[model samples]
Target: MASGTEIPAETVAGRKGALSTVISIDAMGGDRGPAAVVAGLVLSAAELPDARFILHGDQAVLSPLLARAPTLAGRVDLRHAERVVTMEDKPSQVMRHGQGTSMFSTIDAVKNGEAPVAVSCGNTGALMAVAMLRLRKLPGVNRPAIACYWPSRNPSGLNVMLDVGADIKAEAADLLQFAAMGTSYARNSLGLARPRVGLLNVGTEEHKGRAELHQAYAQMSAAASAGEFDFVGFVEGSDIPSDRVDVIVTDGFTGNVALKTGEGTAKLISGFLREALGSTLLARLGALLAMGALKRLQARADPRRANGGVFLGLNGTVIKSHGSADATGIAAAVRLAHQLARADLANRIAARVASTGLAGQDAAATGAEAGTAE
Candidate 1:
């Protein structure tokens, strides 16, 4: 398919209804290949009967997969692409040579308004590079942040955090923008009317951590009312899984490390539990008694339930699923992308950025002004 070519809605057979939501998928991006991607679509189709997909990948490989899955027969429109962006590909390299790649084409569909959202399990850097190149950033957004749902004790069972490896460094003004964007996401996605926001720090004390965080704290406090979120001051890393804050804002470096560490820790705990449960025949009998409760706990802590990392501050919604996501994980990501797209998350972030007034001023100047104003 040509870049930016518009595939008419009539071409998709199962999407004649007016309420159907269209999603573009990078079929060749996941580690497990097109089969996993197609399987995910099938799972999503079973749950979301009104969802339609525009799959971009090699026709030869995807044709047989789609044929086997009768559920997606009329709900999908295939857009063939010859290239694939590997995990090793750098963002700059992909930018220059990724014309017809699946990742690029998937994002292009969203840019052309053929789909409201695009989901890719491709290289994070390459996906973001292509998305920014094609869809561009929303007005007044100096930098785009990647926000993800973290399972927590909130009523919604999740909290929003941003800049999880989208960029390593952020100024005080950027942090404030992340807060605004995160607040909008939490409100729209999690159904929070007034989300509480926090700045991640080494210590919860006002005087702890770097100068930029202090500046960000002051700015967030000043803009919380206008941004429609409550500023909860500084929160330590331990507060991420706590219900005290609904949104946590941090630079990409810290946020990415924390995210990986949390994932690792969850896996470690799961492994320990499995070993302990099967340690003896008596323990196995006890495990059978507790199987129902264990299942509930597993479901609650499942990483697959929170699969997509939303690219905030973009013109269109782009969800970056984990590269190694299985069918279940991909389905979770698809559901998230659909919800955000249906809610018009891009416009919400844009409006929040405009209201917070973080985008208009220079980063350094905004910090100085915020300090003076406080």
Candidate 2:
């Protein structure tokens, strides 16, 4: 039996009749516990009128939290979980003994057809492990990826990047798969007809980078026409948030480092801006006059506004939200999940990969030497 207390069949049936889409959420996996989760749900419920949620967590802790938010009534169905997978838990341990946890319950709902997508603000490694174990990889996927929205100067105001941290290394064929998967993501999430793809390298010159990158470059170039994307050859780190490319493809180690670096740099810049704005009377006066513009800038740079990193290349969609996310961040993650679920992104990615035959192109060379991801 599943560990959590199942919602009564009558209740679920009634909910299914009323709601257009169901999103399964792990209520206890976040650092803020169920309070932030329920609060975020309240926000999501208000924005997504036709959506309902299956919240998994300790009933004792969640019941009161939900009671405090009257707006969430009838929109949320709580499942009682006896335990939680903590940030400190190893992925291996969680995979073996996480059946009773809220995180596992969250993924199981999607696996059982109760929800089309699952959202969890938990340990990234553990969440990926559990999700892969339960949902399994999509056909022709070797290493699943975590794609995130990067603020960019594109018309859509965003770009897609993949393998943020699903695994540390990706072979040439894997990078090829990432490009195809990212193209599908941009099409669905960013509404791009044909997104521009870029391979991360030390320079724009194709001659640079490791041997695997050279192979990936050729593969991406060859596959771009069939994949329905524009391969921009190679891009530097500066191009990540630029309009020059709509998808920045890299191995997980480099991607994860770049992600954290970008986040830290954003925070640092915000702090400097605050300090400079308050440094003198004249600066303070100028700040007041530009408050509206400043607010817009802050909104654009806010990490919480772009909180979800989607786990791509899986049979089912899973959103890995920031572990320390507050209500606003959690709401953003939920909204992203809702968007992807509506778009049927997973199957689209699978179809894209299969169509291009990217997954099977280099099967015999899967174990060959590749670039040093670190």
Candidate 3:
């Protein structure tokens, strides 16, 4: 038997119906191990008293952790998973021999409908492979994408960017699908009705970029009105942090490079500020005077606050937390998964894909008719 704080009065009723509120977690996949995962769960449990967790890991390791987190006892259901997928393991290797592993079990829970969403801080490639194989893609979705929240100058303080690393290649039609999927995600998750969509390109000029991008630009421009999104035409890399667009669509190769570059730049800026603030006695004193403002700035720019990279266009929602994430980052990922699950994000993506498919079919039919008339 496990130990933890009893479920609160308010959450008791909801706990009875755990299917919707439960989140499947891979407790042994992170770099920090089960301790950080459990600590994160404790933090999340404090905030979301009604949310339940289906933890997958070795019972010997997780049992003690749960015993320490009394507040999370009754809310957690542990499933013993003997194996773990390591960071060094290739996706192909894991796919063939990853059965009974925590990551696989965590995703299986969501696929089996035991939980609505799954959160894991594991190998990205392996996780993606397992997810695609198990959860599969939604109807009309050719290639699934990994979408992440980018801190930006938008009113909501964040913008949605997709195809971060799911697939390195995307055609003109795939880009349009990304835009439509991103629009739905913004609407459901960010509460934006008709999000402004922008395609990342070399420049905002009409003739810029590769031939595929140019073709994609024309398609996106023509479909903007019908897609219920405002296409701001082509946008440069700088527009990712700008408030001009709520969704930035790009192929995975470009998006991944941009994502890593942005993360590194943010870290460099933060380090410079710290160094400047502590270089001299007077500088330290000045920092003390501005401590409160600095705290606010740190809070606003904290990457941990936006820890989850959502895998969109799948039949189920899967949140990939950073492998090196600590307790706070894990909690943030759990919080995001809970939010997306509550909003029925999977169903929303399905509807968006279906709509886009119909639109493509209509356009093709129209072109065929025109050819016949000519």
Residues 230-288, candidate 1: write the lDDT tens digits.
Answer: 89999999999899999999999999999999999999999999999999999999999
Best by lDDT: 1
Model 2 TM-score relative to the real fold = 0.91
Q: Looking at model 2, which ten-residue stretch has the lowest summed lDDT?
A: 365-374
* lDDT score for candidate 2 against the true structure: 0.84
Sequence-dependent TM-score of model 1: 0.91
C-alpha lDDT values of all predictions: 0.85, 0.84, 0.84
Model 3 per-residue lDDT tens digits across residues 255-329:
999999999999999999999999999999999999999998887888888898999988789999999999999
What is the lDDT for 89 in model 3? Answer: 95
Total clashing pairs for each candidate: 0, 0, 3
> Which regions in candidate 3 have their CA more than 4 angstroms from the true location?
1-15, 18-20, 356-374
lDDT of 3: 0.84
Clashing pairs in 2: none
